[model samples]
Target: MLLEDHQLQSIQWTELSRGISFGVDGGCLVEAVERLGLVDIVTVSIVPGGQIVLEAPLGNAAAYWHPCFDPGDSLPADWAGRERFSAVRSAPIGVLVDANGQSSFAFSFDCLTQEGEIEFGASEEAKTFVVRLAITDGLAAARSTVRLAVVAPELAHEQAVRELSVLLHDGIAGRQASEIAREPVYSSWYAYSQQISHDVIMRNASVASGIGCKSVFLDDGWQKFGDGRWYAGCGDWVPDTAKFPDLRGTVAELNAAGLQAVMWIAPFLIGEQSAAYSGLARYATHYSEHLRTWVLDPRHREVREHLVAVCTRLMRDYALDGLKIDFLNDVMNYAGTPSTGDVPDVGDAMTLVLSEIAQALESVRPGSLIEFRQPYISPAVAPFADVIRANDCPADADQNRRSTLNLRLLAISQVVHSDPIMWDPSAPVEAVSRQLLNVFFSVPQISMPLDVLPEAHRARAAELLTQWRALRDVLLGGELSVGLPNEGYPVVSSRLGSTLVVAAYQPRLLDLDLEGVSELVILNSTASSALPYTVFGDVPPVGSALAEGETAARVVEFAERGFVEVPAWGITRITLGA
Candidate 1:
């Protein structure tokens, strides 16, 4: 739609489906445009080519937005230095915005379960931005589609991103994620990694249950002993009897402890040391030199069948309520064996595999949760995954904050989760509080061994979890508005009904229209003790509570007070007079 004014000499364009199409060597690039108000949603379906380049007038574009795991500001004009790449489990959408956060251009591809590269380079002579979208693994044998949205200059970047999400969601027919997907979890990955025992898990599960976590996100090292081999023992989904002698009993124990059991499985990674690798190596397209594992090509019926059976047996035999499927994006690294599999395209193969697995797991137990991590949270994978999580940032709270907020925006109706929050057992209470506050919007995943943590630290975790549980609706179900993303989102606020909850990662002004809120909660995640604000209406504060339960600093004269100070790294709940 943005190419309406551009003229090309070599290529001839034709009208198709109220849009445009052009020919490539092997096939045609078809763009179907659906206009929603002033926004043009252009779906570009292409048969693999070297790349597809579209030139658009580069007007007033100052900054760019990508679903990045880290925080940073990038200018589209500076694209000559570096190109951005995204996969199923990484940043999958891109947008160029002006200084006021208004989107100039936005685009996202469907079926990016594999890696796709989007390059934004300026055409100095034409005074336009040359947008290039390509499959990094080279031209595919079948058509893959990328949707581009030309948003009005008045629409904010967040709104533009959500528009793309809506287009992708409907085009792919993604489902409304179940409520169970949003429940808080306690994961064993960061705490124990590959080294975990049944006894250790049970101890943690009891403590986790007491701390308001609804599920035990059992991570890797369950299928094999903690030999520190690092995924070398993957591909086999069976639990190591020594570590989990009674795997079924372990699930039952977790259920009895009021925690759902979710196991971790990597179906694509078959370690050289694994028995499955010996039998299934023929189905693999490439051996990952970095992982030292054979990446199975799921296009093959044998590979998909093998993985589905393994996942089904694991869920049925162990009575697992859910699974944390990992390393799926590996399928994008290489094409499947030529002329050997039922599904040809890597994207199609993955979709089929995930669909079959989800169906099979559901047959075993109703409402079975399927969790996929970042980059993989695209529309194509949305129908299958119940929860989409931030990538592994471990102890980085700010990174988790950025990652989760980005996820929340792109994953519209689906459940988004943070990487399991892990902190030092001796970390200061405020430091621990910051970790919890950072991922306040998404479902919390705590990876600390709660039973082993210091009493004060454990109490803090419990307190925060309690607080989050009480405000889960306002946090997740409410209207989300985030501050400048280029600033790593210094402020994030959600409003539901009459309640407003704002988390300040950096102390700043709260210059907001406070018309609808009867209760305002400000969470101070920064080291600063106070956040400044200006009141707009006639309402005055009637009651106040500090997050740490510290004595009040001072009673503010609302008519003249400019700022309110609370305990550092704590919250202030101001009850407003009606």
Candidate 2:
């Protein structure tokens, strides 16, 4: 059912004749309405005496889904659900889907300020679902416009989410990504975490370059001595002479080994032990007990210039290919130092800092890569971010797969990457294989100590990386479809030209479209040996031609449907017999 303007206004506590100013705090002054068929576009001009809060009610919501909530989180057992949900400048959208995978109601808020809170609950008096949006900071003295949209209910949940991304992207000035941003990467985090040196990375880079990795991310521990302080040494961007005596020379060595070098930096963190902390502690906005670091206030002109200089200097001095900026979501408002800077809103200040850094880096080196991670995966940062990866799910293959898909569905135009895939050296071969196959839809990042891997594990890693390198164009750039997300997206497939690749996570009958297809590759991610498939068009019978990592092809001919008995956690390639 389409929600008309009158219906929306009627549900609100304030009565709107021309425009309502019913509250002493953040009250509306003017209202302009534009109709986009089924979707309603309502623009409100607010004069903020305090924080602004708006509530929208939906009567048909069955399940609520948002980017901040992981797909693996527990679902609602009854009418009780999460009491409060929040969105930062990083992630600012959510949707309500019915049981049939159709979006019942959706909201995308233009909270270009500090942070916004969304509360979801059942209204007992009204018997409806309520979504409340509150913008707590960054209100301008001039007219601050809030664009609230309720999307069409007819769209599939995926389509609805994609449209929301497009809506958000239309408001930002973003840049294009470089060619190398989509390549396979080898990171030094899980393998050696905080205990790396020049020799260790070069050894792994050589092995990674030989096995099809195009880039290496030098994670933490490259910049400070090993005093066991987590982030107390983060603010200073200088490399520790003890760990990497020749930073410039080490970068050259990586480039000589056919790999691009990307350095990691927490640009907003001011470690308590660093000299900058002593001078700039007054500019800090919050303190994090977990990392033992203070969040630098980006609103200050000095603070912004310092971070921009720090990032761009690395690009110029080291001739670096890119930077992996971390912990941007930690830059929100938290009542730290008073706001005494040129930029009024912290959200706008954060945006300005990232934009200036990207602009400056481009002057130093054109097509320099910048990466952001999961909860920070919004089109707002797409102007500077070339890659958006899953959050750190080190050894869990399923979490990597699910997180990448969630990011891909929302940030449709951005290049999505899996978290660095890591595993124990003595893990089973099937477990290692699942790690590679699960991240096929997105760019894969391996964080293993390749030089010291078990012989069998190293061989398998090399073989799968080689295979992924060959099919990356199809896997990353093809038309993709996902099965029921409520069921944890058990089946995902992609097609480019005539090549089709489908990954099945659960043992179920695969219903596929086979019009004008020359090749089919089934990635069995589960332990089921029999993969059952039924083709949907006028297609000829097919034969199993190649079974990877297995001795021979074992097939069973069931006249009713095609079934290939693949090894547990293996890949099978089939050719159509015309």
Candidate 3:
């Protein structure tokens, strides 16, 4: 309903300089042509009907771009080249909104030919607002297209995202939902990092099972040591017999303890010392001087086969339930020549390789869990993986919340996971609960050594986790509503059937409409001692509050449009009247 008001028109092309031309066809498709070198900026001016705002998901765990620019402001500046810009940090999908926070126009590119930036600013020369799509990394004699859409003003953000998701799913490989994607998983990166060993992993898995985690992701440190660098031991996909004397037994033990075993692997990276590095040198598309590793060229048939074989072996030999494919964004050649001899674009290559790996693993083990992180998170790659996790943002709950919400808005039906949550074990129970509560809507992957956590903290985690498990279905599958941007989602609400759940990050009073909603749960994610809330429909005046560190919910008073003094980082559940 929101996309019918605007019409695509006024198609025109302009030659900005030698060997370069830019134009729009049928009002929605923006095309750029380069004959010899890179074309940086192509500007298009339009008279926006309302307040102008742009929404772009960042490349990684950084902030989402939702800046509301005035008549004179410039778009946010770029961060140099792709190497410095972080991998695949910006998606082609963006929304243009009017003053009423309604979608006016939306845009998405089919593929990323090269690393680029699409920015918007007020153009004094044209006396109108202009959108500029810049290719920071020069493309050699190529053409690119950016698809656009005109939507109705009343279309909500979530609805617009749903439409975008459909477009992406149709364009790329679309993923089917899986149960393991929604289950709670434990990761070893935050707890052990490179210090992981067989015994430590089992101990962590044992505790994870005790606290209701269904899977354990054993992160870096399985292969032979290589110069003390975490990824230096990569590319070999072999279990270091020294640390893991009996890999099969370890997996069996974990499965026996009710925990599925997931291993982390970087398919693109080839350590210098790894034997595979010398044998696969011809397949190297990019070399990272920082990590001193070569990024395997996925476009090469042999390279794809190698990656597939690696994943296949992990699933077949070790009998792993899943694989956390890491560093997928590093497959591109940022420093050297962009493309050579009909090589596919980095984005396309990544999609193909990941698809093959996922297919190979699933063939051996049906419904095998596959995890991928940010930057590689696009509709094209979504179909190849079951779980898309927020990138690493250790101890930063706010970033994790933002990343999860951003991913949810884009992934739609897929399981959007939080960055493995790692916080100071010494923090108060209330503080620790805030970490879990921040990502309440998405599947959570805890990466802390539970056995070593303070008893109070462990108990708090168990209480919050239990409540989360009970509400997992509603929280993960419900219709989601994200409040105004830039305010860090002061209020995020999800609704399913007659149940309504709301989480408040800011201290502002939350005004909720509960028509036909029989049950309501509110989570206070702030540091304040209490959360203030009000319901619009006919509901009970009192509810039950579950304070942090407490196992029981105590009866609490809730007057219509009045504040309920919930504990800091706690929750309250209210029942409604018929």
Top-scoring candidate (TM-score):
1
Query: CA lDDT of 384 in candidate 1?
Result: 85
For model 3, give the 10-residue run with minimal summed lDDT: 1-10
Write candidate 1's Cα lDDT for 381-447 as tens digits: 7778878999989899989999899988888667889999999887677768989999999999999
- Angstrom error of the Cα, residue 369, model 1: value is 1.1
Flag the better candidate by lDDT, 1 or 3.
1
| Per-residue lDDT of candidate 3, residues 252-288 (tens digit) | 9999999888888888888777878888877785678
**Cα lDDT tens digits for candidate 2, 496-565:** 9998888898887787776776777788889998878787776345555577856655443324467767
- The TM-score values for the models, in the order shown, are 0.88, 0.87, 0.81
- CA shift at 85, candidate 2, in angstroms? 8.9
Worst 10 residues of 1 by lDDT: 16-25
For model 3, the superposed segments whose C-alpha errors exceed 4 Å read: 1-90, 96-105, 112-116, 122-129, 134-146, 171-173, 334-343, 537-560
* Clashes by residue pair, model 3: 2-151, 2-152, 3-151, 3-152, 51-98, 51-99, 59-89, 175-383
Candidate 3 to truth, TM: 0.81
lDDT score, candidate 2 = 0.72
Q: Candidates sorted by TM-score, descending order?
A: 1, 2, 3
Model 2 poorest 10 in a row by lDDT: 15-24
The candidate that achieves the highest lDDT relative to the unseen native structure: 1
Q: Over the full model, what C-alpha lDDT does candidate 3 score relative to the true structure?
A: 0.65
Query: Whose TM-score is higher: candidate 2's or candidate 3's?
Result: 2
